[model samples]
Structures are given as C-alpha cells and as structure tokens.
Target: MNTTEIFLIAILVIFSAPYLVWRLGRTDYWAPLVVVQILCGILLGPGVLGAFAPAVYDHVFAPPVIAALNGIAWWAVMLFVWVAGIELDLHQAWANRRETGITAGLALGIPLTFGALAAAFLLRWPGWSGPNARDWQAVLGIGMACAVTALPILILLMEKLAILREPLGQRILRYASADDIAIWGVLALILLDWDRIGRQLGFLIAFGVAAVLVRMMMRRLGKADRWYVGIIWLALCGFGADWSGLHYMVGAFLSGAILDAEWFELEAMDAFRSVILLVAMPVFFLSTGLKTSWEGGGPAVFAAAALLLLASVGGKLAGVHLAGRILKWPRRETHVIGWLLQTKALIMIIFANILLDKGIITSATFTALLLMAVASTMLTTPIVAPMLRRLGGA
Candidate 1:
C-alpha cells in the first residue's frame, strides 16, 4: 500500500483496537477507554509489534508513516496542553490559600522526594538518564514525573464519575490546579540551558509583551474570531518557545495560561477539549509507545516501574493523610483525594517526553516511567469509585 493508504490503516487500527477492548471487554471499572488506548499503543508499538511481527509493524509504521503520525501527535498534545492551561483556576486555590498550600505542598513534595530517591537508586546502574543529562537533571526529571498529576485526565475521570461540577470535584481541581502550575514551573527549571539563557530570557520578555497585546485582541474579538486567533497565537508561541530552547509545549501552555478561561464560553471550551481528545490524541499515545525501548531489559524496566509506582502511590497517600491530620479534614476523604491526585498518565507522559527529548532520561527509563504512569492511572477509578460511594456519593 502507499504511504497515504497505510497511514489511514494505522489510524484505523489506533482507534479500533482500544475501543474494542474497552467497550467489549467492559473494562470501564478498572481501565477506562483512555487507559485502554494507551495500553494498546504500547502493545502496538515497535517494542511489542515490531519485535513479534516485524513485517506487519514495518509495513504499517514505516519511517514516513511514523513521521506523519508524529506531526499529528505534536500538534495534538500542544492543543491539549493549551486547553489544560486555560482550565487552570488558580484563583480558587488562592482564595483557600492555607488549605490549598498545605495540601498541594505535601501532595507534591513527598512524592518528589520518594521519586528522586528512586531515581538516585536507578542511577547506581546505567542506561537510565539521557545522554545529555546531568545527574541532578535526571534525578529531578524522574522525580517530577512521579509527582505529576494529569489535571486534564483528572477532569475527565471526575466528569465520568459525575462529580465534575460538584463542590468536592472543584476542591480536587483547586489542588490539582496549584500542582499544575508547579509542574510547568519545574519543567521550565529543568529545561534551562545555561548556554541559551539569553535566548530563553528573550523569549520570556517578548512573550510578556506579546501576551498583553494578545489579551487585548481576544477581548475585542467575537467568539469565532477569538478561537481562530487563539490557534494562531498557539502556533506562534509554540514556534517561539522551540526557537528559544524551552520546547514548544511550554509555549503552548503559556499561550493558554495567559488567556482567561472566561474569555471563551464554558461549554465551547469543554467541547473543544473533547474534540481534540476524540480526534487527535490517540496518535500521541501511539507515538509515545513507539519510543518505548527495552535495551536495558524488560524485567529491569518493569521493576523500575514498580518501584516508581510504589513511591508515587505510597508517598501521595502518606502526604495527603498528614495534610488531613494537620488541617483536620474529614479522615475518610483523605483516601479519596489522595487516590484522585495520584492519577498520572497524560501529563506524566508529556513530562517524560520532554526528558527523553532532552536526553535527560534514556528510552529504557522512559519505558519504565510510561509503565508506571499507565498503572497509576488504571488504579485511580477502581480505588476512588468505592471510596466515593462509601463517602455517600461521587
């Protein structure tokens, strides 16, 4: 088949295999469709399909096809991250500063410490950190991976559980909102290239000036024009960030973060996010899986994943429990909140992608983090559902 035909075939398979498993197998309780899709991406990736069925994998995912898929994946993720930024409601967290500070700090700090320790241990061996990475960079990158919560995915799961607009759900979003800001801030720190500091500083300064103008433009335009201009802004910011050595994803997030969510209609914003997820993000998942490598050995990778999982899960629960005690929150709610905050996958994968791209972590380490993210996300619904039920509702 021609590349075009084969690319279409690849898209068909990406959308099909996962939906069948999630829908037909009725795995919603344990694994949602998004989780199922991520798993299938890995299974369909070179590490699995390419190893077992080289002919099929090669025919379907040739270099050209892979390149095409990557183009889509990059744009898809940029848009998704932009939406997540627009969704941030830091005002709520600020209004409840004491509670939000203690909770977000502990929730993030403990897992970071645990994951950094795990990264330090992994460094005792080789093939984990990326080629260009300094020791501290590798450790902090992996540590933050453990600490991340996919606020976008968290919103999806909460909507699934029918609590998205509820007070409890909003509380969860507030906590995640604070953490989201911190996640990007840490990413900026890790991506700092001393050699290119001048460029990055220039990008920030230009962005600040451009942002004021963009915000003014957005306010004057009608909704339709705003949407179109936003896309234009997203692309330019993405280009500028990449040119500045900070990465396009950082620019994408900043582009959206600078614009208030209120500028767009709520339903329209939600629908836009939904459309991106439904139409584009599957390719990102597959592209991510394509980068999975087992050069350091499968067993070792799985073990590392398990170690990270333990640290991420245990540290989050412990930290949340401590916060609950300090703030005198209802005892039972701590478990529910901790499990929800532990939801990882999307944002964590995005974080690890930057690490791998920068050579701060090797493909082997990326594979480990990928596996850890999948398992962490899978655990969220099953664990939280029952807790929410017992707490009287979702």
Candidate 2:
C-alpha cells in the first residue's frame, strides 16, 4: 500500500481496536476507554505485536506511516498538556492552602521517597539506568514518575463517577492542581543542563517578559481571538523550550498555565479537551507504544513494573492515611482519596517519555514505567467505588 493508505490503516487500527474492546468488553468501571487505548498501544508495540508478527507490524507501521503518526501525536499531546495547564486552579488551592498543602505534600512526598528507593535498587543492576544519566538524575526522574498524578485523567474519572461537581471532587482537584505545578517545576530541575545553562536561563528570562505581554494581549482580545492566539503562543513556547534543551512539553504546559482558564467558556474548554482525546491522543498513545521495548527481557520488565506499582500504590495510600489522621478525615475517606490520587496515566507517561527522550532512563525502564502506569490507572475506579459507597458517597 501507498504511504497514505498505510497511514490510514494505522489510524484505523489505533482508533478502532481499543474502542471495540473498551466498548464491547464494558471495561469502563476498571478500565476507561483511555486506559484501554494505552494498554492497546503497548500490545501493538514492537515488543509485543512485532515479536509475534514482524511482517504485519512492519508493513502497517512503515517509516512514513510512523512519521505521519508521530507528527499528529506530537501536536495532540502538546494540546492535551496545554489544556491540562489551563485547567489548573491554583486560586482555589490558595484559598484552601492549609488542607491542600498537607494533602498534596504528603501524597507527593511519600511516593517520591518510595520510588527513589526503588530506583536506587534498580541502579544496582544493569539495563535500568540510561547511558547519559547520572545516578541522581535516574533516581529523581523515576521518583517524580511515581509521584505524578494525571490531573486530566483524574477529572475524567471523577466525571465518570458523577462526583465532579461535588465538594470532595473540588477538594481533590485542588490537591492535584498544587501537585501539578510541582511536577513541572521538578521536571525543569531534572532537565537542567549545566552545559546549556546560559541558554536555559536566557529562555526563562525571556519567557517571563513575554508572559507579561502575552497576558496583557490576551486580556484585550475577544474570546475567539484569544483561542487563535493561544495556539500560536503554545507553538512558540514549545519551540523555545526545545531549543533550550528543557523539552517542548514543558513549554506547552507553561504556555497555558500562565493564561486564565476563565478566559475561555467552560463548556467549550471541556468539549475541546474531549475532542482532542477522542481524535488526536490515540496517535500519541500509539507512538508511545512504538517506543516500548523489553530489552532487559519481558519477565524482568514485568517484575520491575510490579515492584514500582507496589511502591506507587502503597506509598500513596500510606501518605493519605497519614493526612487523614492529621486532618481527622472520616473513616473511609483516605482510602477513597488515595486510590483516586494514585490514578497515574497520561501525566506519568508523559513524564517517563521525557526521561526516555533525555536518555535518563532506558527503553526497558520506560516499558516498566509504562506497565506500572497502566496498572495503577486500572486499579483506581474499582478500588475507589466501593470505598466511596461505604464512606457515605463521593
């Protein structure tokens, strides 16, 4: 088949296979369509599908097709991250500073500690850390991965559970919002290139000045113009970040983070997010899958994934329980909240992708983190629902 035809075939499989399984199998309770799509990406990756049917995989995912898909995936994830940035409600977090601080701090801190220890253990062996990584870089990167909560996915899950408008949901959003800011700040720290420190510093200084001008212009524009200008702003920030060696997604997040979410209509913002997920994000998931490899062996990858899953879930639960005790939350509230906060999918995957791209983690390590994220997300709804039911509702 021609490049166009093959690209369409790839897209067909990407969108259709996961949707069929998610819809037909009725996995919404445990595995939402997004989670299912991520899993399907792994299954279709070179390690799995290519191992079993190399010819088919090669023919379908030819170089031209992969490149086309990657172009789409790049912009798709950029837009997704930008939306996530805009959705951050730090004002609400500031209003409830004490509660948000204690909850977000413990929830993030404990998991990071546990994950750092796990990364330490992995570093004792071969194939886990990347060639370019320092021991500290490897540990910190993986640690942050464990601590990340997918704020966007959390919103989706809460909406599905019908608690998105509830007080509890609002509280969760505040905590996640605070943590979201920390996650990117830490990412910038990790990506700090002393060799390119001059360039990176220049980028930050320039961005600060540009941000002032951009906010002023945004305030003066109509809503329609604001949306168009936002895209241009996003692209420029992405380019600047990438040029500075900090990576483009960080730039994408900052582009939206500096802007007020209220500038756009809430309904349109929500609809835009959903449309991006439904259409473009599947390609990002597929591209992510293409990068997966079991270079250290499948069994080793699975074992590492299991280990990280334990650290992530156990640490999150432990931290939340401590917070509950301190704040005197109700009996079952901590379990429900912890499970919900443990939901790591898009953001964690994005974090790992950055680490992999920067050569802080090897492909095997990325695969392990990928598996851990899928498992962590799948465990969220089933675990939280029963707890919410027993806790007098979400």
Candidate 3:
C-alpha cells in the first residue's frame, strides 16, 4: 500500500481499537477512554506488537507513514498543552492563597523529594539514565515527572464525578493551577542548555515583550479573532523555545499561560478541548507508544513502574495528609483530595516525553514512567468514588 493508505490504516487502528475496548469492556468506571487509549498505544508499540510481528509493524509504520503521523502528533500535543495552560485558574489560587499554597506546596514538594530519592536508586543501575544526561538532570527530571498532575485529565475526571463546578472541585483546581506553573518553570530550568544560554535568555526577553502585546490584543479582539491569533502565538512561542534549546512544549505552555481563560467563551473552550481529544490526541498517544522499549527487559520495566507508582501515590497522600492536619480539613477530605491530586495522565506523559526528547532519560525509563502514569490515573476514580460516598454517608 501507499504511504497515505498505510497512514489511514494506522489512524483507523488507533481510534477504533481503544474505543472498542473502552466501550465493550465497560472499563469506564475505572479506566476512562483516554486511559484505555494510552494502554492500547503501549500494546501496539514496537516493544509488544512489533516484537511479535516485525514484518507487519514495518509495513504499517513505514518511515514516510511515521513521519506523517508525527507531524499530526506534534501539533496535537502542542494545542492540547496550550489549552491546558490557558485553563489554569491562577486568580482563584491567589484568592485562596494560604490554603492553595500549603496544599500545592506540600503536594508537589513531598512527591518530588521521594521521587528524587527513587531516581537516585535507579541511577545505580545502567540503562535507566540517558546518554546525554547528567546525574542531577536524570534525578530532577524523574522527580518532576512524579510530581506532575495532569490538569486537563484532572478536569475531565472531576466532570465525570459530577463535582467539576462544586466548591471542592474549584478548590482542587486552584491547587493544581499553582502546581502547573511550577511544573513548567522547573521544566524550563531542567532543559536549559549552557552552550545556548544566550539564546535562551533572548527567548525569555522576546517572550516578555511579545506577551504584553499579545495580552493587550487579546483583550481588544473578538473571541473568534482571539482564537485564530492564539494559534499563531502558540506556533511562534513553540519555535522560539525550540530554537533556544528549551523544548517547544514549554513554549506552547507559556503561550497559553499568559492569556486569561476568561477572555474566551467557556462553552467554546470546552468544545475545542473535547474536539482536540477526540480527533488529534490519539495520534500523539500512538507516537508515544512507538517510542517505548524494553531494553532493560519487561520485568525490569514493570518493576520500575511499580516502584515509581508507589513513590508517587505514597508521597502525594503523605503530603496531603500533612496538609489536612495543618489546615484542619473536614473528615475524609484529605483522602479524597489526595487521590484526586494523585491523578497523572496527560501532563505526566507530556513531562516524560520532554525528558526523553532532551535525552535526560532512557527509553526504558520512559516506558516505566508511562506505565506508572497510566496506573496512577486508573486508580483515581475507583478510590475517590468510594471515599466520597463514605464522606457523604458520614
């Protein structure tokens, strides 16, 4: 078949396989369609499907076909991250400064510490750290991955639980918003290239000037015009960051972060996000899976994933429990919040992707982190639903 035909078949498989499993298997309560899609990607990757059927894999994912798919994936993830950035509710976080600070601080800090320790241990073993990574870079990158919360996925899960507009949901958003900013800031720090320091500084200076103009123009324009301009801004920022040795994803996040969410119509934002997920993000997931490897072997990868999952979940809960004690939260609130905050899907995946792109972590480490994120997200709804029910009963 031609490249176009092969690419179409790949796309068909990407969307259809996940939807079938998600719908027919009835995993919605525990594993959402997004989670299932990620799993399907892993299964279809070179490590799994390609290992068994190399001939088929080569034909289906030919170089030209893969390149075509990657173009779609890059744009898809950029837009997704940009939307997540735009949706951050920093104003709400500021309004509840004390509580948001305490919660977001402990929640991010504790996991990061534990994850760093875990990464320290992983460093003892070969094949976990990438060729280009310094010891500190590997540790910090992995640690930050554990600390990431998928703000976009968290919003989706909250809507599923019917608490998206509730007081508690709004509170959660504030905490996550604060952490989101920190996550991207730390990412920029990790990605900083000494050799390209001048370029990096230039990018920052340019961004600052451009942001002022962008914000002003956004305020004056119609919503429709703003949407068009936002994409142009997203592309420009992404290019600038990539040119500066920081990843384009960082640029994409900054592109949206400077804009006010209130500038766009809420309904339109929701529809845009949903449409992107439905149409574009599956390609990103497929691209992610294609990068997976088992160089350290399946058992080692799974073990690493389990260990990281323990660190991520344990650290999050421990930090939140400490916050509950300090802030004197209501009964069961801490448990519910901990599980909800522990949710890691899109954001963590994106974080790990950047780490891999920068050669800070190996493919084995990336595979493990991917599995940990999938498992972490799958556990959220099941655990939180029961906790919420018990809290309601009390």
lDDT tens string, model 2, 1-394?
6899999999999999999999999999889999999999999999999999999999999998998998999999999999999999999999999999999999999999999999999899999998889999999999889999999999999998888899999999999999999999999999999999999999999999999999999999999999999999999999999999999999999999999999999999999999999999999999999999997998999999998998999998888889999999985877888999999999999999999999999999999999999999999998888777777743
Ranking by TM-score: 3, 2, 1
Model 3 weakest lDDT span, ten residues long: 385-394
Clashing pairs in 2: none
TM-score: model 1 vs. ground truth: 0.98
| TM-score for each model | 0.98, 0.99, 0.99
Residue 11, model 3: Cα distance from true site in angstroms: 0.8
Poorest stretch of ten by lDDT in candidate 1: 385-394
Q: What is every candidate's alpha-carbon RMSD to the true fold?
A: 1.1, 1.0, 0.7
Positional deviation of residue 21's Cα in model 3 after best superposition, in angstroms: 0.5
Question: How do the residues 242-311 of candidate 1 rate in per-residue lDDT, one tens digit apiece?
Answer: 9999999999999998988998999999999989988999999999999999889999999999999999
- The lDDT for every candidate, in the order shown, is 0.93, 0.94, 0.94
Tell me which residue pairs clash in candidate 3: none
